[model samples]
Target: MYILQTVVVKQVLTEKMKRQLLLSYEEQKSQLQREYEQLRFEQKKAEKKYKNSKKESAQLYEKEMQKRLDKIQNIEFQVNQLSLLPLGSELKEQELQTMTEVNVGDRWSDIENEKTIIIKDGIIIDIR
Candidate 1:
C-alpha cells in the first residue's frame, strides 16, 4: 500500500529543533545498537544450546535462530535508515493525512515511497 509521508515546509527549520532531533536520533541509534547486541547474544546462545540437542529440537532452535537473524536484519536496516531522517533538513514528514486540500505543493519520492507532492492554490507541485 502507498502511504503519504514526509512533508516539508519552506525554510522553517530552527537550530533548537535540529538539536532536539539530533539528540532523539542519537538515542534511537543507541537503542538499536543495544537491541542488535542482544540479538547476537541470543543467537549465539541458541546455537550453543542446539549444538547437541536431538534432531527435533535442533530444527526448532534453527527456526528460532532464523527468526532472530531476520529481526536483526530488520533492525539493522532501520538503524541505517535512521541516519537519513530529515532532522535538520527543510522538509518534515506529514505524520497525518489531515491535509485534504492544498493550493500548491511539490512532489518527490524515495526508495520505498513514491512522489513527494506539494499542492498549493489547487495546483499540484512536483518537487521530486
Candidate 2:
C-alpha cells in the first residue's frame, strides 16, 4: 500500500513538472512573439516617418528604416524558432521513426517548433 502511494505521488509530481516545463516554453515563445509584433509596429512607424521626410532627412530616415528592417527580420526569426516547443509543434525533422502504424488524421508535433507532421496511410505525407 505504501509503495503504491509513493508511485502515485511520483507520477503526480512528474506530471506537474511537465506542466511547468510546458508553461515556461509557452512564456518564452509568447515573449518572442510580442517582441516581434512590437518591432513590426516600430518599423511601420519608421516607414511612415521616412516617407514624410525631406531629402537629407529622408536619407537619414532611410538608413534608420534599413536598421529597423534588420531588427524586425531578426525578431521574426527568433519568433519562428521559438514557435516549436512542449505546447505545440508543426516542424518536420530529418530523423525517421521505426514505428509505422498511424491513422490518416494522426498528428505528430515537432519537439523544437510549431510544426506538425501529417500521417496518411501509415506514412508521413506532409509537415505543417
Candidate 3:
C-alpha cells in the first residue's frame, strides 16, 4: 500500500511540472508578439514622416524654379527695350540729304535716268 501511494504522488508532481512549463512557454510567446506589434507601429510612423518631408521638398524646389524663370523674363524684357533705341554718335538731324525732290506720279524710267545722271556726276543718290 505504501508503494502505491508513492507512485501516485510522483505522477501528480510530474503533471504539475508539465503545466508550469506550458504556461511559461505561452507567456514568452505573448511577450514576443507584443514587441513585434510595437515595432510595426513605429515603422509606419517613420514612413509617414519621410513621405511628408519629400513632398515639402518638391514644393520648395518648384517655387525656387519659378522665381528664377520670372527673374530671367524680366531681364529679357529690359534687354529688348534697350535694343529698339538708335545706335552710334550720329543723331537723326546729322544725316546728309541724298535724294532729289520728285513729284508724285513720277515714272520708274525717269527715276532710272536720274540715277544714271547722278552716277555720272560722281554724286550718290537714293530714290524711293
Q: Which structure among the candidates has the greatest lDDT?
A: 1
Provide C-alpha RMSD values for all models, in order: 10.1, 17.0, 49.2
Which 10-residue window in model 2 sums to the lowest lDDT? 1-10
TM-score of each: 0.42, 0.32, 0.30
* Candidate 2 structure quality by residue, lDDT tens digits, 68-109: 566656655655555444432333323433333344554433
Alpha carbon RMSD to native, model 2: 17.0
Question: lDDT of model 2 at residue 65?
Answer: 55
Q: How many residue pairs clash in model 3?
A: 0
Model 3 CA deviation exceeding 4 Å by range:
1-13, 52-128
The local distance difference test score of each candidate is 0.52, 0.46, 0.41
Instruction: Give the TM-score comparing model 3 with the true structure, all chains together.
Output: 0.30
Q: Kindly indicate the candidate among 1 and 3 with the higher lDDT.
A: 1
Report the candidate with higher lDDT, 2 versus 3: 2
**lDDT tens readout by residue for model 3, 1-128:** 01111001111113343345346555655555555455455545656777857655555545655554565555455445434533321111122323444557766465444221111122323222
lDDT of 1 by residue, 1-60 (tens): 244444443332445654555576667656656765675676567677777654666566
